[model samples]
Target: MKNVSDEELMILVSNGNLDMMSILFDRYHVRIYNFLLKMTRDQDVSQDITQEVFYKVLKYRTSYKKGKFSSWIYTIARNVFSDHYQKQKNKDQRLNDIHYKTIGQETNSVDDEEIKEQLHLALMKLSHSDRELIIMNRYQGIKYQEIAEIMDSTEGAVKTKVHRAIHKLKEYYLQKI
Candidate 1:
């Protein structure tokens, strides 16, 4: 069979073709997990959020609209992250602790890893919207137009938000240093 686009796979999934789900999952799972991992900085939370994103995708497939499928999934991922953060008021502090330990274990050079740790800390200091804009633009490589669609804002607004987010991140890095 020919490969289906993510939108096509979602349409298939909505039509009750259960087999299409795995294809959709395969296409997006790694990126979603990695995005969540970068946001939450917890492997387990990333796993849970990734699972939730798919579950929401499957459960709400009937409601899928046309446009960029990745944006739809990204909107879902953002909701999942927000819900998780709401449940744990100290989420950043928890992730901060885990972030250092993870860098220590994963990187060969302590200095490079420490810089990563510092960056992670800087990211944590950013506002939620600022962090999300960076994630959508930088990590996910989402186009500003698509991000505007997902965010329900104008493309110009998305551009401004991303620019402001970058400025905030810079301030965060400066403060950390």
Candidate 2:
């Protein structure tokens, strides 16, 4: 099962091999959670949105196409986040309350922690789309081609967007410093 590609697992799940869904979940759940966490900056909301993403995969399993499964799953996750954002917008909820949690390392220095927190705040100050673009490219290490596919844009356009997003993030980070 570990040797099976994500696309194959998705196809099997789509074909009624329900157990394959778990495999897909195991493969992508953390990445999806981290993606959502960076976007929403809320642990609980990220968890809920991650669950919704998988539920959507199950609900729309039959619609799976033969392509990069990462792109397809990311597309679904993007849609889920958009829907959640819209609802929050209608409710007048603030989306900028990003509390940055250290994801993988323990910082030993106070200055380092402060710098990380400031950087996180700067990232949160970016527009939602820009923040997502940076997170997907920089943090999650998704390819430009796959991001373009999920975004329904040309690879060149995705590259340009990512470049601009990085520039904007840099400006913001510099301003904070």
Estimated TM-score for each candidate:
0.88, 0.93
Error of 1 at 85 (Å): 1.2
Q: What would the per-residue lDDT of candidate 1 be over residues 1-177, giving only the tens digit for each residue?
A: 346688887777888897988887888899899888778877878899999999998888889876679889989999988888877766554433453226226667878877876777788888878888888789888899988988989999999999988888888878867
CA lDDT, every model vs. true structure: 0.82, 0.90
Question: What lDDT score is found at residue 141 in candidate 1?
Answer: 88
Q: Determine the C-alpha RMSD for candidate 1 after optimal superposition of all C-alphas.
A: 2.6
Best by lDDT: 2
lDDT of 2 by residue, 51-109 (tens): 99999999999999888999999999999999999898888876864344556668789
Reference-based TM-score, model 2: 0.93
Alpha-carbon error at 164 in model 2, in Å?
Answer: 0.8
